[model samples]
Target: MSAEQDSVFVRNFALVIATLVGVTVLLIVIANSVFGDMDPERQALAEERAEQNLSPDFAVRLSGEPAPAIASADSGADEGGVTEVRSGEQVTQAVCIACHQGNFLNAPGIGDKAAWNERIGKGWETLTQNVADGYGNMPAQGGAASEEEIRAAIEWMVESETGLEVPES
Candidate 1:
């Protein structure tokens, strides 16, 4: 192309870029004008949601350190501050159901007699110990529940649900 043609092309390109920049700035200004004043309640909710989203889902604890206290919706503590133990059904629903319901990670499904039979043969003590210390794809339940609660959950998930009693060793 000739020098004149190149200059004209360059000028046109600059004008196009300038127009695009102008349009972008105009849109930004219009958007700010339209949405600059957010509703107080909406703003509060947005901030809260952002905080929740940014919060860590899990925390790390060093070995030998005391385990973090588990939070319960219905603490059910008496005047003596001794928290009432949750029932087997409740513990099963809250903790075990996540994996057991769907048989996640090859976990035995709730009420699956065949699956329970295989593990039930392992007996209550063995099963409870396995559950307490992460077994297979399952994480340890010791942090989530007391030994009694773990036993109850096992009874509910294996015996009560499957109609197969776990052998007490």
Candidate 2:
């Protein structure tokens, strides 16, 4: 291209860049003028939302550190310092239902007599122990529920649902 044409092209390009920069600046100014004077209520709401969004969902604890106290809905304990034991149905619905309802990870489906029949043969003690320790794809439920709760869940999931009594060992 000729020098004149190159100069014209450069001038046009410069103009285009300058226009974009001016437009950007104008937009920023307009936005600040429109939103800078936020009402106290709106500003407070925005701040609250920001705090909620930025809050961490979980905490990390190193090994051997004392576990953080968990907030429970029912914090009342009995005279013996034992918290109220949840019923079979409650435990089964709350914990066992997650896996047992759908037979997830090859877990026996709730109310599946055929499946419970096989496990029922393993007897109550064995089945409860297996559940407490975790068997197959199931994780150790000992941490989630106490031994009494575990037994209740098994009774509910196996005996009540399947109509097959777990043989007491």
Candidate 3:
């Protein structure tokens, strides 16, 4: 082929390659924005680029499935992934109180001694299971609290109702 023709062919190939690269980048950027940070590839890249020495104690961590955490009565429950140690009262206030406060969805009101008495007699296992599996109009774990958190909230409500303390096992 002639040198001039060869040069023209090279330039055209280069232009095509550059165009393809630019279009690929634009498509990636659009997908990242539309899919948000949940895009696996984008999220992995962001996490890899994030400061390696950053402390989790200062930041909220995200995960697909939360790891199980050991719960203590004095310290409270810690559902893994975020490692937030929430107290029973905190759980109740954040979740249970919404429904239990006024019998919304026929939930037993927090301080309703009579209403609580019958349910409380069913024992901790039954009550906790109910919270975990969902009971009546209440969703499973009500607000999706960990098993320990549900137990704590149940104990807190029982005590508030009848001045009886439920053991945390």
Model 1 lDDT vs. the true structure?
0.85
lDDT per model vs. reference? 0.85, 0.84, 0.77
How many collisions between residues are there in candidate 2? 0
Candidate 2 lDDT for residue 167: 78
Q: Any idea how many clashes model 3 has?
A: 0
Error of 2 at 34 (Å): 48
Per-prediction TM-score:
0.53, 0.53, 0.49
lDDT of model 2 at residue 150?
96
Per-residue lDDT of candidate 1, residues 58-163 (tens digit)? 4454565554445556655534334678789999999999999998999999899998887788877888999999888999889998889999998888788878
Tens-digit lDDT track for model 3 on 67-140?
A: 44545554444544235646778898988898888899898888788888677766788789889998879888
Clashing pairs in 3: none
